[model samples]
Target: MAALRQMQTEFNNVANRLVAQWRLEDGDAWAVIVAAAVAMLLWLTPHA
Candidate 1:
């Protein structure tokens, strides 16, 4: 339980720092996120 708590605290700190560092507006962020997801899907799809 103690190790789990420490892991959660570390994860939260990293997430908070990432949120603070990112500059994209909500719309731009969503667009980029969706585009990346689509690209990832395409890359993973098997081509015949």
Candidate 2:
């Protein structure tokens, strides 16, 4: 669909810009994100 194509194009543009600016390895970025998410989850969990 036209809408989906437009959304994809916009996403690609933003991602490209970020990739250019950040200059970080994609794998390293994802690892850091996952680690932060897990730490937040642990902090929020109620203990018995």
Candidate 3:
């Protein structure tokens, strides 16, 4: 029982870390792409 609990804790920790990292990476990439697109649009559109 104790071993199973320990294994479960470890698994949960690993899963949390993976999820956090994946989210950070995905968010960063999306932000970069969106920023680049907005920059391009601003550059292309003329403002008086």
Candidate 4:
């Protein structure tokens, strides 16, 4: 449980950073959508 919690926290941090950086670089809503899509794909991909 603790490990899962840690992973979730780290994922959130990375997603937030990506969103912020992309938003700054693009200055548009598409940056946010792209960031979210990337994050979702990363999370959904199988890890084996």
TM-score of each model, in listed order: 0.49, 0.49, 0.48, 0.51
* Candidate 4 structure lDDT: 0.68
Which residue runs does candidate 2 get wrong by more than 4 Å? 24-48
What are the RMSDs of all candidates, in order? 9.0, 9.7, 18.5, 4.4
lDDT of each: 0.58, 0.60, 0.61, 0.68
**Cand. 1 Cα-lDDT:** 0.58
Give the higher-lDDT candidate: 3 or 4. Answer: 4
Q: Residue-pair clashes per candidate, as listed?
A: 0, 0, 0, 0
Residue-by-residue lDDT tens digits, candidate 2, 1-48: 676567557756665665566666877655655675576557546531
Question: What are the clashing pairs of model 2?
Answer: none
lDDT of 1 by residue, 6-40 (tens): 75577566545554556556566556556755775
Best candidate according to lDDT: 4
Clashing pairs in 3: none
The better-scoring model by lDDT among 2 and 3 is: 3
Q: Rank the candidates by lDDT, best first.
A: 4, 3, 2, 1
C-alpha lDDT (0 to 100) for residue 13 of candidate 4:
83
TM-score computed on alpha carbons, candidate 4: 0.51
lDDT tens readout by residue for model 4, 1-48: 677667767877876777677775655645665777687668756651
Task: Give the per-residue Cα lDDT of candidate 3 at 28.
Answer: 69
What candidate 1 gets wrong by more than 4 Å, as runs, is 25-48
